[model samples]
Each structure stands twice: as structure tokens, then as C-alpha cells.
Target: MADGIDQLPVVRTITCSHPSHAGYEKDFSEFWTGAPDSKLTNRGDTKKWNGGFRGRPALADALWPELRNYLIGRKPSIFNNAITALRAFWRFLDGYERYGMEPISQLSDISTSLSILWLNPIDEMWSAHSRQAHEIIGVLVRNARKREKMQSAWAWHPYPRAESTESKELPTEGQIRTAMHLLKQSAYGIYARWKRADAMAAEGKNLLTVSRSRQGERNQKGQLKRAFDFELTEADAHATYRAFIASSGNPLPSMADLFVALGLNGKDYPPWWPTYSQDHPQAGQVVR
Candidate 1:
């Protein structure tokens, strides 16, 4: 079975007596008997390959489409036993009768000349059906050889040479959502501030406005038309009175000067103001 590996015929029958099929049989034998047995079971030959070449487990009948979709859609065309084993195994089994049916007289003998081309897979026939099967087998062979090399190379080297792979902490879903929300909110705030500044510059810089009249008389009534009259309002009297008391010795502005500056008169002034003292000893002249 091992010699003339390329010319080895398709599996005609799987039986315990033939030690020929050992590639995947060992691992699969455990499935049928639960415990590993000495050799292949009598039932092993009769058992349907069911996609498992040696002893692989059967795929659930319902998931065939999902499995097919997944395998076909996968990138890089994964060429592993899980992908190609079942189909090739079944093909070999079904084609068994047709392959052996040919007359023995018609069989070619390589007694005289050797075809080293067969020993080395010729590129011309690389895409051939039989050769494609070998190609898949070659992938497994190359993988096994690579693993063997890695194992042998590492045998004498340090055991802990492989760098430890540390797991990283990734942000949570909530954190991602929060970050997006904050970015959008910050963008809106910046835009609002820019628009507000533009609007403020367009109209004289003001965040609030009071009613105004275009052609009103310049009297106490005109106070209503002033753009900013907070200093002339009723609150202004109280604030000014407090300031005057606070600055009593600092030389107060004369009553006439105050009336002119504040758009007021001694006539319109409250009764308490007429008696107020203007005679500070230090006040040689009122500071208007």
C-alpha cells in the first residue's frame, strides 16, 4: 500500500484484514466502538463512509446547506480534510467498481522503463482529476512535513521561546456609543458658539434686547427707546443711592449735575432727596 503510492487503486473495500488504509482510520475507530480497539472492526467495512473517510463523524443531515455556504464563502479556499475529505472519499468509494472493471490484459506494466514524471507530479497533469485529488492530499502532506520540521527544530531549543500572547481590554459597546454621542454634541456646541458670535457681531454685541422707538421725543419717555436703559431704570436709583452713600466723602456730583447726567430734575426727584445734605466740609467744589 505504501509503495507505488501514486498508482495505488481507489479503495475497493474497507476491511480489518487490509492494513492498507491507516491514514485516518486510527482516529475514527474510536467513534464506532466508544473505546479504541486493537484493529479495525468487522462492521467498519460495512459502515457507510458517511463523509468520514476513515472514521470521521457524519454531518447532521439538515445543516448541509449552511455548511456548504460557509465553506464556499470562506476566503483563501481552505483545503483541509473538513472541506474536501468527504467528497473525495465518497468519489473513491463510488468509482471503485468502474476503476477495477477494466481487463487485466489492458493494464500497462512499468517493468521496462520508469516514469519518474509520475513520482514527481508533472505540471501538465497537475490539474487532472486524479492529480487534483493528489493536490489536496499534497496539502495535508506538506502540512505534516512542516509540523515535523517545526517539532524537530524545537526539540533541542528552549521550551519557553514562544512569546506569551497577552489579551487586551477593548472598550465596551456603551463606551463606544458614549464617545460618538459626545463627538456629535461637541460639534453642535462649537457650531452654536460660532453662529452666536457671528450674530452678536452683526447686531451690536448683545445677548438680550429691549423695546426701542425710532422718532420718540427726547424726554423721560425717551428712556423707553434707549437700547440699554438698565442704568436709567428704577433699580438705577437704588444702586446709585448706595454708591453715593459709599462715596460720601469722595466729593459727590452736584444735584444739578446729577439731574443732567441721569435725565432727571429736582422737580421729579423723590421728596427724601430735597433735604439731603450737600455741605461736606471737604467739598470746596462738587466733582461733576
Candidate 2:
């Protein structure tokens, strides 16, 4: 039974055959007729008396709270009745419709649901848990239809991924060689020279070889002074390079030449060259 209830068909009617207000009026008449105070009159029985008793307000106070509870809780029954009333009211205003009446609940959600359910051929009420539930369902239906139309317009075809133009325009082998040659002449090469000099200096030697004499010169006091000769071993060169690297804040060397300005090594120096070839294939090789 619970499964059946879960699978129950939706009722999407705008209204029933009769208006609830009309039903209330009919019942009210019957109640009035049964009243003990009910009295009849002749054509001129009293000057103030009319043919019928004065009509009471259509709805009672108790009915209002029941209606309020239904709308607040979105109890399915209130949702349906409110929608029904709205549809009837609209139809009544249209004048062309024979059956139309105002609805009980003035809630916005209830009115929205009525607009949708009123579209159904069966013209039945749709129950919802909350006033907004009606609006939510309408939105879902509208979005679903929009998605369907979008799918059909392209014949349900899938779009292919776009290829990157940059990849297709890759540089040729000649361009690569030209880039390498230009890089060799860049500041990176200068840094490499400084790194080699620094490494050598760490080992208590200089990477640059001074061909000047080791002979001493006489001092002011007639004492002989040792020559200012400079040369660096491989380990010293490596240490010198480390120091140069530290002065750089570990940043990649800029394109401009900072090496020559620091006097690491130069074209004037040969054989005692600043760099260790092969180990440093690039202009500058960073040691880990």
C-alpha cells in the first residue's frame, strides 16, 4: 500500500466541477432553514422584514486558521485547494468561462502551482508539501523542456575538442640552434664563469692564472715582498662558484652580464679557464 501510494499518479486539475464557495453557500442555506428562529412573512407582514434572512459572511473564523495551517505546512490538501480556487477565480474573471471562483488560500506558491496544473487536460488539483513546492516543480519542468530543445537543435551531436594553435606552430630545428647560440652569448654564460672562479677561490686558489713573476720586490724598509701570483685548483674553483651563487640570492641569473663586471674570468685568461666543460653543457649549470 505504501509503495502504491508512493507511485500514485499525479492529479493536475485546475478545479473540480463545483466551486468550494458555492458548496459552502448551499450548506449554509440548509443550516439556516433548520434554525428555530426561522420565520416566514406575508407580502406586507412587516415594514422592515425582507423575503430572506440576512446572509452571514461566506467564511467562518475557524476556517481561516485551518487554511493558514494548510498553507504554512504546505500540507498537500491546502496546496491543491488553493490552486483550484485561483484557477476558478481567473476563469470567473475571464467572464467567458461558466465556472470560475476565488480560491481560499492567497499564498503565492499555491497560485503558481495552479497555473501549471491548470494546463493539464484532466483539470485536477496537484498536492504539494509547501507553497514553494509548486514553483519549484514549474521551474523543473521549464528547465527540462529547455534542455530537451537544446539537445534536439544540434541533433544530439557531440562537439570535438579544439586543438592548440601554439602546439602546431612549434619552432623548427634551425630556430632551436639559433636560440642555443644566442643563449651561449647571454648573461647565463657570465654567471657560469663567476661560479667557476668562486669554486676555485674556496680552495685557496684563483681560477685565473697570472703569468707575472713570483720574484719579490723591495719594500720601503728594504725587506723583500712576496709576488702577488694567483691560480686556483678544481676544488677551489668549485668553492668560488658556490660563493658567487650565494651573492645572487639563489635567483636565476639575469640576461645582462654580471660576471664580467665582477671580474670572475675573461678572454685574457686561457688554460686556467673558469668552467669545467662537459659537466656544464649549458651556459650555466646549477650544482645541487
Candidate 3:
């Protein structure tokens, strides 16, 4: 029986009369041939694949567990594609019954079971991918029922949203200061490196001859030089500060002079009021 099964020709095509069903047929054929332990043999071959199960019953029994095992440490995109292929297989089975073949059990049962497996406590990190897969499967099942002219038992159930694991607390003032200091230091270092490079270039020497750490400091310096070809003006800083104040919903105390210069009454005025003055100091004056 095993040898006979191994000699069975691989499924190369899935036929359906519906024009819209062509893509699903192709996907199913590809999956059937490619899936591990699929008992169907390749053309002119008699060996069974090592990884996939034999037929629909074997697939139905082992698909989810095998899929979960395949997805271990895989990327989210790969997981999405795997689920898509599985859903296509289910769609093929549902459509095949239109030609007088026996109907398989509703795939929703398998989807629900897989969803529970995805939510297993030991592998909590895959919750997002699992939710996405569940939603995709739900959509596929709904579409398959509509195409087959059958009533759908697959009820819509919301997948639980994954909570963010990142820290939500705002940075402390000290932390902010430290970040600013680091930024200044980085800027200074980049500037010094560029100056050295410029001097080397002026002396008819290759800029690459300058000392650069393995962290791609040379590439970084080149990028920085190209980026800051033009100097940032005082107006830029003023605009940035104003934008920050607006976004932060904080009153701009230091910018009161800027408001007076712009002719807006700075005293007891709402933060958004525009001020203009003929002698108004450049927007950079207050910022400086």
C-alpha cells in the first residue's frame, strides 16, 4: 500500500469551471506538490517527500501542527505566505466538491483549532502573526462559502489585540539632557572628521586615507557632509521650536519676546496668537 501510494502521480492541476477560481486552483497545486510528506509522486518518480503528509486526511490531521513547527523563528512575511497557501488548499477542497466529490468538513474548525494553538502560552510572541493568520483564514472561508453557494458556519470572532511591550513612560529630564549631549558630541565628531577629510582632499590626497573606525564612520561622515551642504538658519530653529511648543501644548515663555517682535501681545495671550513688529528680532534671536 505504501509503495503504491508513493507511485501515485502528483496533482498538477485543479480544474474548476468558475473563472474567478483559477488562482486558487493554481495555488493548491503548487502547495500539494511542494508540501512535505505529500504522498503524490513527482512525474516519473516513485519516492515520497519526507516532510508532508500523504493525502487530505493526513493533511487535515497534521497541517496546523506542522505549520506551527515550520514557522518556528521564521519571519512574519513567511508566516503570512504559509497561511495563505494553507487557505488556498482549503478553498480548493471546498470548490472540488462542486464537481460531485465528497465535501470535506468545514475548514473553520481547523482554523479555530489553529488559532488556539497560536495562542499557546509557551509561544506568546507569535500572537500578532497568529491573529493576522486567523483573520486571513476567516476571509478565505467566507469567500469559499459564497462561491460554493453554501451557508457558512464560520462566525466572525475578533482576534485579541496584542499589547505593546515597549516602555510607555516619558523620558526624564536628565535622560533628555543626556540624549541632547550625545547628539552634540556626535555632531562635533562628524564635523571634525569632515574637516580632516576636506583638508586631505585640498592637499591632493584621498579622503579615504583618514582614520575611520569599523563602525562605517567614513561613510557616515560622507553622508553628513552631503546632507548639510547648506547651513541651518535661525528661522529654521524658530520654526522647529514653535512646532515643538504647538505639539507639546506648552506655553512658550522664552518666545514672549518673539511674540512682541511679531506685534502679538505676549501678555496673557493664548499661545497660538501671532505677533509681528517692524523691529521684530529675527526668529532666531529668542531661540538663541
Candidate 4:
């Protein structure tokens, strides 16, 4: 009887029959096997890899920690691969009715694991890999819970990195005056060029509309001339404005702000001005 039992074929049981189960099985199998031939040595190591989760409890208790350990000090590519595999496994488990709802303890466990990874020490000069790891963990954990729950958990924190120091020396009166003068000149130049461009755009639109409406012999010959005029004027206006902006070397306000600075009334502005003013109530208002 023992010999007969040993000879019997092994059977596998699948509790969930959802179509996604097949995809889950495939992802889990690939994660278990790992990519040994890949250039990354850590990725090729199968011993450290956790054969995918058997259930929700296993996923939270075993697989999460395994992934956190595997990703430590690893290259971004390998870290991303592990994260992707874990996401697929989690998604599959979440879809399956039997293990869909995650318990609070499991969520807490995963959050703690992420916090530990995030707080891991690194060199004084922060590395790109460390930043990437922090971002990935934050995104994954945030997505795992609802917005309200995430706010309540309060486990997540800003990335662990050095803050830049503020300059201690203040500008002298002469330096401040010189800077202000340069900024004013640049702003005035930009405003003038913007107004020219705005006028040209309005004229071009009118010319184009007129050219399009002329369908009779009385206006046929002048239609092409009008269209060419519109295009040339529009092109020149845009080019001049762009060149002025590029050369200004200073931050400038929006066209509407420039219009107001030039003392133009909002009521006499283009048709789009009303809509824009409604959307951005502060646009035409004077800024102090």
C-alpha cells in the first residue's frame, strides 16, 4: 500500500477559477525562477528569491519582508523588477474572492516593512538609487490603501535626505538696486513685444476670416494675397515675441498681466479675455 501511494501521480488544487488566476500563476512561477542569465548578479540569485505567495497571510508575513531585504543596496533595475513581480502577485490575490480583503494587521506589517526600508542609512551624498527606492515604496504603499486610510496611518514621511543650506550673506543696497533696474528693463521689453504680437494675431485672424469668406470672382485674386499677409504677419509676431522672451533672462508674468501693467483696460481686450478672467480672477488684477 505504501509503494502504491508513492507511485500515485501528484495533484494540484486551485481554489479560484477566475481567468486572472492563470496570469497570477505565470507571474508567480517567473518570480520563483528569477532571471539568472541577466547581467545583474543579485537578480540571478534564486536562493534569495521567495517562491510566490500561497495565500494572503503568506504574502504579508513572508513575501513582503523577502522583497524588502532583496531590494536593499540593489541596483534600480533589479529593485524595480522585484517590485513589479510583487505588484502582480498582490493584484492577483486582491482579485481572488477568497483573499480579496486585506486585514489591518497585514496592512500594518507591510507599512512597517516599507518604513524600515525607507529609513535605511545611506552615504551623506544622496544616491539616485536611494531616492528611487524611496519613491517606489511610497507609491506602492499609498496605492495599497484608500486616501482616507493613508492619511490616518501616518506611517509615510518625506524622503530621508540632506536639506540644502540657506545663504547667510545679504545683498548690499547697490546690488539690490542694480538687480531691480535690470528686472524692470527686461519686464518692459517683454511687455512691448507681447503687445505687438497680440495686435498682429488679431489682424491675422481677421485677414484669414475675410480670405476664407471670399468665394466670388470679385475677391478671388486678393484672397491668396490676404492669406499670405496673415501668415507672414503671424509668423513675424510670434518669432519676435519668442526671441524677446528668450533674451530677457528673467521671469515674466502672463500676457494678461503684461496687458494690465501696460495700463490696458480688460473690457477692451480680446474675446478670450472675459473667459480667461473668469477662470483666473487674479490674472488681470494688479499684483503688489
| Number of backbone collisions per candidate | 0, 23, 11, 0
Q: What is the C-alpha lDDT of each candidate?
A: 0.30, 0.33, 0.39, 0.36
Report the candidate with higher TM-score, 3 versus 4: 3
- Best model per TM-score: 3
Q: Rank the candidates by TM-score, best first.
A: 3, 4, 2, 1
lDDT of 3 at 247: 37
> Which 10 consecutive positions of candidate 2 have the poorest summed lDDT?
151-160
Weakest lDDT window of 10 consecutive positions for candidate 4: 1-10
Greater lDDT among 1 and 2 belongs to: 2
The reply for model 3, stretches above 4 Å from the true place, is: 1-7, 12-27, 30-34, 37-54, 57-118, 121-131, 165-288
Number of the top lDDT candidate = 3
Predicted candidate 4 versus true structure: per-residue lDDT over 91-183, tens digit per residue: 333222232223323553453223332243122111123455454655555445442243221234446567676988888999987876775
TM-score of each: 0.16, 0.19, 0.27, 0.23
Candidate 3 TM-score, C-alpha based? 0.27
Q: 1-288 in candidate 2: lDDT tens per residue?
A: 001111223222222223443222112221111112224456645443111221111222222333333345343454555644433332322221212434432222122223322322122222223334333333332343343342111011111234668555778999987875664354234434544543444454322233434346655644324333543344544443334433443223332223343342322322333344355554333322
Candidate 1 global lDDT: 0.30
- Model 4 has an lDDT value of 0.36
lDDT of predicted model 3: 0.39
